[model samples]
Target: MTQKTFLVTGAAGFIGYHTSERLLARGDKVVGLDNLNSYYDVRLKESRLARLQQHENFRFIKCDLADKAGMEQVFRQHQFDVVINLAAQAGVRYSLTNPHAYTDSNVTGFLNVLEGVRHSGVPHLVFASTSSIYGANTKQPFSETQNVDHPLTLYAATKKANEVMAHSYAHLFDFAVTGLRFFTVYGPWGRPDMALFLFTKGILEGKPIDVFNHGDMVRDFTYVDDIVTGVVAAADNPPEGDKNWDGDEPNPATSYAKYRVFNIGNNKPVKLMEFIEAIEESVGKKAIKNLMPIQPGDVPSTCADVSALEKAVGFKPDTSVKVGVENFVRWYREYYRV
Candidate 1:
């Protein structure tokens, strides 16, 4: 493929940072955008941004997706080949105390991106969605074909809203828009609040780690690299309007428009205790466990049905939990000098 330009929102974020790196590595011009919010450590965001800055083809823009004027200005300035919206207020539990943040970033910010894409004539728009949208769902492996009408948390609700909002724009404006529902993504440079980061930090420092759901949870823990692979593949090939899509029995995953949603996750599900053990073995330390009940808006389990992704992208996220945990552990130790 020839050189292309991509506008990656939340460029300083974990998945966003990795996605920008992948695009730059392929000799693509990447205009990265981020608000540099203190949702987590601004220093961590800066560290990731600094590394991306080393690439000559990579340009950084510090702008929030919610800033309508700033976002409009960005679209006006750049002639992007593809626009990937990964910026959002991320966190399941944090949504409880900070509801406004979810609306401001996930809902309002996402709308701004849609408007920008609609007007800018960007051919393709790929944005991040989450498996948390599968709330009140007891299914073993969540499928994209299932109805996601009952989101348990504000964060999940906002993301579900994004999927709905994107579909409308795709139908009305006629452009390819893909939404990826990422399962428990974890790897190097992951968010601090994630289970792996917290468990690794607590184990290395001899502190008690809070194991929610009393260590009986299940997650299809996907490695970040695998997630990025699926993301790029989806971005590369934009889906077209499904001509045979039936209105009688509508498929939730695809629409009559050039829009779709896919689950990007390791098909293998690992128990919470097993995931913790992997981290412990990697760190060579045991965690002082404070097993607690499943918190509000927390699901007991999550497993992704990635068959749609495989058929569409010709790939599946097959990274092993052991290898992924070890990678994160090594990065944590080296980055923090633990």
Candidate 2:
């Protein structure tokens, strides 16, 4: 394989850091960009970056995606073969109170990324979209072909906006663009805000864990390693314009332009209570469950149809929830000295 120089936004982020590590492991040069905002524990972000810094092939940039001038300068400085965008104001419930953050990061920040990729002549731009965009759809397994016009939260809306924005850029600029709709991702070095981390911490501390929707929620919990595998594969194989694409019966997942969307998920949906049980088993402690009603902007379930990703990249996420949760618990214990 030819060595390629890649730029990954949110390199300090969970998925971004893992993706960069994968690229570097393959002897590719990676320039990781992140603002390291206070959305979560900044120490965790720094720790992730520290691990990346140990690699000679890795470079770090302290920049936000919304910073147009800074983004332009970075693009001018580096000749990236591919740009994988994973940075965003993430969280469905958080979007309810802090709505502007989503617009700034997901919407405007994404615009900056698109402009950077466009001007830099980057061949492939693989960005992170969310399964949350499948909001309000009662489909058993969420597919990229389904209509995602009815997003329940502001965060999902912004991500949905990103899909259309990238498509427009692909049509006008003729660049290869692929959007990946990620399911619930968890693993070692996972985000503290995610359920696995929260449940683990709460269980170990003998604190009550918030069981949302009366513990009736279902999620396609994907491991970060599997997510990174799909991401790298997509980056390596950029989408080509679909020649058989028809305008009359246009598909939401593909187009006549060089743009496509694929769902990267574990395909298996596990119940919320079952996930908590896995955590409890891993921690050797049962959680004090505080059953609560479903919060606003929250969905009852999320299951992905990853057939398109498998067809495109010859891979799909197959990690089981039990194994994935155990991995997270192991990491959490070591990281927090529990």
TM-score of 2: 0.99
Badly placed stretches (over 4 Å) of model 1 are: none
Q: Please, what are the lDDT tens digits per residue for candidate 2 over residues 172-250?
A: 9999999999999999998888998888888999999999999999999999999999999999999999999999998
> Model 1: number of clashes?
0
Ten consecutive residues with minimal summed lDDT in candidate 1?
312-321
Error of 2 at 296 (Å): 0.9
Top-scoring candidate (lDDT): 1
Error of 2 at 191 (Å): 1.1
Cα error of candidate 1 at position 295, Å: 0.3
CA lDDT of every candidate: 0.94, 0.93
Q: What is the lDDT, from 0 to 100, of the residue 102 in candidate 2?
A: 96
